[model samples]
Target: MQLAIGISACLLGQKVRYDGGHKASEFCLSQLQPYVRYQAVCPENAIGLGTPRPAIRLMKKTQGDIHLVQVSDASIDHTDAMHQFTEQALPAMSALAGFIVCAKSPSCGMERVRLFNEQGHQLGKAGVGLFTRQLMQRYPWLPVEEDGRLHDPMLWENFITRIFACHDYQQLCREGFSVGALVAFHSRYKFLVMAHSPSAYRELGRLVAQAKLFEPEELKQRYLQDLMHALKQACSRKTHANVLQHLQGFFKKHLSSKERQELSSLIDRFRLGHLPLMAPITLLLHHLSRFEHPYLAAQTYLQPFPEALGLRG
Candidate 1:
């Protein structure tokens, strides 16, 4: 629904890379465009390094400090400048639901940007890009993903779901936070959270149960942190199967024994990887539409992101 996302300009097809090339993601253009309004920024451009400029690299010193240095001149560094830009950018990105960064770039890669020694020898692919490192540290609750990683189904789905969940939390801030609201929000996301981290599922439930004991702002802060952290852990087929079984229990009175058997079979096929998650989810939704199970119907696990994105598929 036009959720605003902060994205690397290059990933959105802007020519902001050092060589003036873009690292546009096909799914972002074809599937996500309609649902999200992107605020594209090129950290290199923001730091006054215009497009077509010389490449920069992360220099890892023996003492373990990494600096964004010019390829030819290690003495020339942009680390501080990128940090200053991040200081300004993050505060202004309150509306952003997530960030999509360029991979293996000095300015925007989320991880594994190559680190080099002073002699220009490759140290390792261990450096997080300058700008993205700050972007994440400053807002650890925010969903940050590299464009390259989005090609994987699990990572893609996790990142997409986290963003939508973050947006929901942000919306609660707009709608006014209350104990009842927080509980309802947590309730809808119960299975979704459990699928990601059962420990977090338990922790968040305890937090919400005692939500009234904490100040409103404190409750919001803690709940949001726990929610995002839980989602950062990827879901397993076992967990999805558990969640599917939980959903199945809701339709017991309504479904005939044959229908129940079919539902269980679909869930098993999905758990075995023979069918996509959508198979069992589709069957569940069919029951959801005709059934009067309000709680099951309200669960976001059944429909996390827009189905058109096909992150699950």
Candidate 2:
């Protein structure tokens, strides 16, 4: 329920830039702020680069090159500066269960920052924000998304759910793995796994049932790893189809024939990409309360956080 969300200063409507402009995200403020504690950080401003500073771009290199240098004062390496800030921020970042980064920043971009040649012509989206890369490398399981993707309900829901899961996993690690924790965790993710890989879910269940025989320490590590792995495998479209179909079966008795047929047709359209997973998933989640049991409903699954963080502008 409590989460630490690292967000871009601009997204929070802060005038931290050199130019004194803000790119505020109303949704983040109204929705997410109420759910968790937010820690805002702008790397450009943090590194003593004031707002309205000369716009920095990533200089492209010819093939077989992997050099990352500052756009201005190429000779004055800023790599160390980035490293220094990451080191300083590590302690502050350790407790955060998730992050929301600004997409496409040279120092903060998570993925697909624009690469340019010497002349600043468009090359390709190849580079990651220096700090973003470091954060991922340090905490592989932490949920991190770009602010843009949060606009989509599916992506937004996925990110928050994943953050909670990661936070819960860390707690499990602290308290030690037990049959109760394992059962509860499995229940939360059961339908989700069914969508991705039913076989893997079964295998994981078997593992959890047998966890009693192994050393407690070993069980903790093995279970957490397997649990995360199951979630990873469960993220595909094919898996989602399986889960939705199963959920549909549960609702047949409750829904009228016409409604059943309409829902089935929508599911089919979703399979063909005529509709996004959100449309059906949204309806299912709303009705999930009817099922009572958390595991049997289709609302319990989560998507990987990285896919949710987006910056289109």
**Candidate 1, 1-313: lDDT as tens digits:** 4688999888888888899888889968877788889999998899899779988999988888899999989999998998899898888886788999889998888888899998999988988988888888888888999888988878888899999999988898778899999988998999999999989999999999889899999898889989999999999888999999999999999999999999999999999999988899999999988887889888999999887776775
Question: Candidate 1, which segments miss by more than 4 Å at Cα?
Answer: none
Number of colliding residue pairs in model 2: 9
Question: What is the lDDT of every predicted structure here?
Answer: 0.89, 0.70
Q: Which stretches in model 2 have alpha-carbon errors above 4 Å?
A: 59-70, 116-123, 152-154, 171-176, 196-203, 206-238, 244-313
Per-residue lDDT tens digits for candidate 2, residues 1-313, read 4667788888899986546787788767876676678888887778777767756656655663433455665554466677788889977787677898877877777889987775556679988777888888886656788877777766666666567666777666567667788777777667766665788789888987887888877777676656555554425566777778887887777777887787788778888778877667666655666556444542455332323343111
Count of residue pairs whose backbone atoms collide, per candidate: 0, 9
Best by TM-score: 1
TM-score of 2: 0.70
Worst 10 residues of 2 by lDDT: 304-313
